[model samples]
Target: MLAASNRLAGAIAFGLALTLGAGLGAVARGDHVVVHRVGASAPAPTPSATPKPTPTADRSGTVSQQRVRHIAEREGFAFLRPPGRNGEVSRWDPCVPIHYVVDVEIGPPTAAADIAWAIAQVSKATGMRFVDDGTTAEQPDDRRKDVRHTKSGWRWAPVLIALVPDSVFHGKGLHADKDSLAYTDPAIYSDEAGDAEIVTAQVVVDADDITDGGHEDPGALGPTLLHEFGHLAGLDHVHRSGEIMQPDGGGVVSYGPGDLAGLHYVGRAHGCVADAALPTDSDDFPR
Candidate 1:
């Protein structure tokens, strides 16, 4: 009777293991490392061995392809990654890295006159000038996970207002829309080489909500452009209020001393390993 009962118990345990989809088979039994043999999508166990941080990729290659010409010495910010929901979560997040790329779209029948007006508006708000008279081209549909549409700073082609049905300026942040200002990943992107999959910004213009202050719009669409440009230019938000990065934006229209330093570092050097030593913007990042 005792032998029969022991056999029955073993059978029950084996059945329980099989029922858990194999992934949970390695039931933890105290200090021992339980090796679960589940499906292919199981979360990777944290390495028990000495953890060496993944080395950032070298960014020497593709020098000619970058968009921003001058990198300033400002602090840096990160682009956000796509969050995978459901069973697909493991395939991403800590895995499917996000990249940073900014693209502007134009509205249809708007023509050169409209784009010129828009550029003039943006330039006036930010106190920057655009004298480039480059040729125009059609914007591509698939602007995500691809680099073909990306144009280097020197090769900027002015898009006509007529070609774009609408226009919106975008800035990089955690959400799909720039309604909130948060970055999900800051470190993973610092490497520079593995940042293509990330999203820098995406904006669309609403005819009703346009403004000259740029901050007048909720997207802060104007500031968003500058903010992302600052990132590309290598500026991070400083902790000061009345600065461009402060919430309830106003007054701080131009890049502060901190902003300039960061921009110089990134635009000129492409990397500012010692950016912390440079300076911090007195204005805080948007809350």
Candidate 2:
């Protein structure tokens, strides 16, 4: 369950609880997410398993698109949407590879590697690419930072994946769950046509939730990262039990077939806009 900013949260309600799944298999209830201060950074990825292995191939660990479709039809998949009884799907104007950064305050020894692994899986499934902006010193804030151009001329805000202590969320007495494995804040932008597009996002995991953090096994942490990034990629929780996008503490560890199908559709959107284009005053995606 990924949680957006306060404003975004207000727009979501029980929707964006960040990455609530943890391979525990439990439907999330009362997804009270902590609205922490904002922060983001970057770095090269290096997991303990190996230098980031290639993303799963069509016939790799991830299920095939055919199977994904079958699963979705049999069970069903969900996309993150704007608040309301209606499930209004929120996707990028045109599906495109996404860039991101990794800011680590704490995590497993293979944290970077775990991130890389998760990236490969998502990229393989959605045909999306990830960019590591190196790293940053910004502290985590619950509010959304306006994305724009930095003094360096690069896009100011990119997706940020951070490993932080629980205190960062708990200390603030944020409304998030105590067993919060990780959460994400994906900034949703609308196009001139009033369609939602996800440009930049942030993912935060409890440093203490992973094996190195005295919670789950080091290897088990990869699934948590994958699930949160899934949220970043515009996925919503499904009632289906054995999926990565299930409720918090779910044990799905990897993207299920249904989850993969939704990702493909999201990545398949038509995005003519620049990956980092700022909304114009003449016409902008509703902020």
Candidate 3:
């Protein structure tokens, strides 16, 4: 089920689902500028009759554990999901490398380089590593799975970053307006202990807004890409000036001091999440 709210400048929508014994669920929200919240529920998937293998930890502890230099200005940053009573906010497992793929079918010529630049900035801020899987034919899906079956075996799905036409948003049950620059949907997993981790996410940009002629121009797509990537990294919109996580992009091409601080808080400096388990095939989503 889904619920939506309207504002003078833009619209916001939310979708919620509950998945029974699997303890899996999702809460989705999106907007052009103004943010709103809504709640709804869906029937859970029936549990598989056959017992499944015990879930194992995916963190390898091989990634370098480097702490980011503390930033003096931290007031401008905020988390999309605020910290729980345990003082931990949802974030990706910093020990594992985040894999991603690009769908450039409708992207500008500079799409590849532009994405790399933005990811590089985020990587520097957070100690999280990202592996580029090059281009993929896969399109964006709001109900994307946490893992995919490959010839080698089952592994976590790669983060998808795509440049699609505005019309594509009209389908896929997405709530963004045709004029919205971009939208990001992150799949998260939480345990009974209240610890949560973002397993995968999707970043979709409006290809129509970024054409070949102005692809290289400043602010054409850089700020928007960074803003959405920040969302993928769990940073939420902040009204403070000069921050890339601003609701309207804030006309800034790079991350501000607060953005850096927030990224570090969710970054590798926090140490590995050894007990974080990757969801199995039977585990239903928004987990």
Candidate 4:
């Protein structure tokens, strides 16, 4: 029994010695312990990534056709529309072409005040003298009171600058059967009219506001007038945005250089007698 107790005491002593040795080792390694934090915000958790905004179509502002026309005329391009035509056009006429006699009836013409302002802008930019043949700032309803009839056709002057309020765009007002279209000579450009007799009348369709890129009118004011003038100048819409003859008017302001070049070519070279019979063939108008 004494021998068994001695063995147990030795074992206990050995355990105590091992424990003491471990404590000594820990003491020797003082300040060597590494502490790690693992809390929710221990290192200031990064913010979740924010989502980016999706891209959208531009729907910001509106533009005026008159402003566009002013830009064209300012750039030394004479903007003329035949009495009644659709689409837009720019031309430089050396002589009064048969088409020049036509007056494009711009619906919703501008108010008197606006008209004067537009004329002033045109005069300043174009440096061409504009003769006002009509009265000032009359309501669009009374526009017919100032109409003057001519031998070749009727002349309505003082370009309508203001658009009618809440005016919706109908199609071109010109047709063979429409009586309101008084200047309906089948010979749009013929041998009868002298070169100097062809006169262009500018008409503005007054509307409450101009349309935007999305809700554009096919026969709006500036576009309509320009288109008619192209016809008067013996050119048709080329379906090219660069050309003023383009039917679909959008964000563009004036005829590109190509259009001006074409205008010079057609106005000086192509005459009503020679080019009148050709069908309106151009692939360059606005689609």
Best by lDDT: 3
TM-score for each candidate, following the candidate numbering:
0.32, 0.64, 0.71, 0.33
- Listed per candidate, the RMSD to the true structure in angstroms reads 21.3, 13.9, 13.9, 39.3
Total clashes in model 1, counting residue pairs 3 or more apart in sequence or in different chains: 47
Order by lDDT, highest first? 3, 2, 4, 1
lDDT, residue 133, candidate 4? 46
- lDDT of residue 203 for candidate 3: 83
lDDT of each: 0.26, 0.52, 0.60, 0.29
What's the distance in Å from true for residue 5, model 4?
A: 99
Query: Candidate 2 on 108-166: residue-level lDDT in tens?
Result: 67777888888888777777667676766665555545343344332326777877777
Tens digits of lDDT, candidate 1, 1-287: 33543443344444433442223212111111111111112243222111121123423323431211112112321112111121010011211112322223332233234434434433443333345334334332212111112232111112211121222222231121233221111111111122211112222232222333444342334443444344322223333443443322223445545444443332322221221110011111000
Top candidate, metric TM-score: 3
Worst 10 residues of 3 by lDDT: 8-17
- Evaluation by TM-score, superior candidate among 2 and 3: 3
Error of 1 at 171 (Å): 16
User: Could you give candidate 3's per-residue lDDT for residues 1-287 as a string of tens digits?
Assistant: 12111221021111111111222433232222212111001122222111221112322222221011112123457665545445566788999899999998777777888899889988998999999998999988665555565554445679998888778855666645433557777766666555677777888877776534342332466656777888788777666787767666665668888888888878899887655544421123222
TM-score of candidate 1 versus the correct structure, residues matched by position: 0.32
Residue pairs in collision within model 3: 26-286, 188-287
Predict model 3's lDDT versus the native: 0.60
* Candidate 2 displacement at residue 91 in angstroms: 1.9
